[model samples]
Target chain A: MSREPIRDSVADLLADSGLADDGVLAHALESLRALCPPEAPEPSGALADLLRYGSEAVGAAAPSRAAHRAAEAAAGNLSPRVAPAVPLPPRKLHRGAAISAAVIAGVGLSASGVAALGGVDYSANPPQAEVRSSAAAPAEADASVPGQASKSPDATVHQAQAFAAAASGGSVAHEQPAAPSRGASDNALAGDGAAASSHAVAPSAAVWRSERSGAARAAAAAADDALAGIGRDDAAVTASQGAPRHRADSAPSRGRHVAQEAAAVAQALVAAGAEPIKEAVALGQQVRTVAPSLAGLGSRH
Target chain B: MTDSLTDHDLVAGVLPETELFSRVYQSLAPAVLGYVGARGVEDPEALMQDVFLSVLPRIGEITGGVAGLRTFVFSVAHARVVDHYRRVERRPRSVDYDPLLDMRAVPSAEAEALVRTGQTDAHLLIGSLKPEQRDVLMLRIVGELSVDDVASVLGKTPGAVKQLQRRGLKVLREMVSEGVMAQ
Candidate 1:
């Protein structure tokens, strides 16, 4: 039932086997035999034993689920062994010290308030009225100079006559023509009735007063000349018959005369065309009025 | 009885571990051992353990049963032999000692003398050949590897391996015939 290669195959195999029961082939085989392990007659048997042991070891050492579960439980039981962190105690809030501090602060504020109010003048009127009276004193002085000038017209006229007589070589002759014209203008101004009425309210009250004064001075000079001419006739009669009546009249008239004289002198000066002196006097008066306040300011500095 | 049952079942059943593993070890171990033993290794058991230990881990890779194993074991054994030879070659040369006269392990004077003479013959014969020829011969005869395996290991063409083998054999034959070495 099996196919075979003929006897020729056997002869070929025997020839290649190189076995005269022992030949080069035997020597080659012997060389291999010599290299074989002394204890392992068959190297393949040892290899098989190793393989069996390895397989059995793998099979016997299979992982167990119970062991795996136990390991998992042990791992799960391992919580971090954490110590409890101690809490810090609450801080004490001292209200007593806080209230004391607030009271000190309130007292400080109240002291500052009392210091501010203490500077106030509560029950006393200040010296503003006294200051006002002192401030009015310069204006009173200006008024007094006008009154004094009204009573000195005759003296001023004589002084002016003297100066004119001296300058004109002792011929102190009055210009009677100029007198009538001046008298007519003065009467016109006085008759306006408005100028006389507005003596208290006129914005040009100083000019009106000055012009009235000039007319009055001219009238007084005329009266003084008449008297002087009468006195030239009889010294005794001039002194006795009219002297007492004249003297009584003179005292009353003297006040009017003095006012007229001062007016005359001012008119003579003005007629002499010296407005520069008038302006200088006005400016001098203004400077004198402002001088006291200036002194007060200097002292303050 | 259970071991017998397992053995019988293994031999007869689907997975034949007893037969497969047993055949692998039995058929191959001797060739590997003989190849290693010829190299004058004193401890053949250690070498045998190494070869099998290496092979056992990779035993599942044998695709074709005996033929696959034959190729693998021989290749591994050859690698092991080459490794052993390289290590031996690296040993220090006897400086104050005589290598020929160091025969303390030899049981008899005749054997000692023979080994000394063989050593001399080997030195002369191998020394006379070209380095390439000697390499080929050593890989073939000492390493116990086939010409093809030798070519693969040496990274040479099979033609070059054949050429080197022929030259080396020719040189050895000439040396023996010229009586350059004692028979």
Candidate 2:
């Protein structure tokens, strides 16, 4: 018998049955092993690099405090079973008390505005400055209040009452809560200013958008000039020493004029009673009409 | 320090900087490197380092002592290789090789001799097989994994792996015989 056939049969048996128990298959496998030997060659420079990498990784493995806590938590080592129990008070109570105090002060001011106003020296406080501005700028004040009042009529009345009480000396203690209302007014002023500025820029922006004719281009340039004039007037008004420095700090220079205009409206609402709320609602209607005109001008330009 | 200590015993407490780790590294590093290198990975050594580093952290989790440890290490190596390919896919295009710049001005005579006669023949022969066949054969032979272990690594049934191994070896044997007859 040719050894080739025997070798072939052995190879077939080894392939079929795997490396178990057949002496002939084993012999064939061993002989063929030389053809495709196991690659046991040590990777040159790998050992050193591996050692270095492992050492560095090991060195860096020391957990940070937060990581250690997290790991402990993951392992259930930091579970509540291991923790000490202590009763903790709710924090919301303190906030509730502050709000109650502010409400009481607001009620007092609304109940007796003349008495409250007489008790406080207006020149000493910046908010008192707002009261004076309200008298000077009733239309603007009426314009700003209705939008806010419409959102929450009851809250606006309460807020106006709070401002009146705040203007009066209900409790200097309630000033902290009143600070947030002042901040709200500042934000409202800034928002109104931004809306007006957007309106003023809309026509020029439309000209740039269409680029249809010389008339449109000239209109765009006129709008730009008008915007520039507004900006210069704002700078002059803001620069005035007697003008409320508080308003300048509350809004950006670009929105200073709009902010001042809105601030005057806010002051009028605060100083006057519920009567201004109706006027503000009317002014709000006027604003709605004017806004469409501004948007239309942008397209026409 | 004895070789007789089971992998479970070695990892019974906190993992130590003991001789056991060194022994395991010495025994498995070459096989792991070979497996990674055989796959034509860009950096087999770095991947091998990753495999070992990953193994070190999770050695305690392994059961079945030495055998389990071996399976775990190879599994980690396989996962890392898959991750490497995934990363290569997501990365920006690799630089093209310039033959003029890449070619050695003067090839090392010793290195050339090693390439001609040393391990390249076996690697080249193994490379000739289909990817699945090649993986099964290498894991079985070089990684010294059992049929089941190879199946797990390749995500195939034991029967499928056996068939692949059988087919791969047969093709290898034929190629060897043809090379011999030519000579």
Tens digits of per-residue lDDT for model 1, A1-301: 0012112222232233332342332232223222333334543343445456655543443323332332233223322356659754433346667789899999999999997776543221223422332243333223222332322333444544443333223444453222323344445335444435543454464664464444334433443542343233224333445433322223222223223323343334333323233542343244333433333332222
Cα displacement (angstroms), candidate 1, residue B137, comes to 5.8
DockQ for the candidate 1 complex?
A: 0.07
> In model 2, which runs have C-alpha deviations exceeding 4 angstroms?
A1-301, B1-15, B101-119, B180-183
* After superposition, candidate 1 runs with Cα above 4 Å error: A1-39, A42-54, A58-301, B1-15, B40-42, B85-146, B175-183
Q: What is the DockQ for all candidates, taken in turn? A: 0.07, 0.06
Q: TM-score (0 to 1) for chain A, all models?
A: 0.18, 0.18
* lDDT measured at residue A278 in model 2 versus the true structure, 0 to 100: 43
Q: How many clashes does the backbone of model 2 have? A: 2
Kindly list the per-residue Cα lDDT of model 2 for residues A114-194, writing each as its tens digit: 766655333424444444445556554555544332222223323433454453434333322442343454454445644
* Model 2 residue A50 CA deviation in Å: 9.7
lDDT of 1 at A54: 52
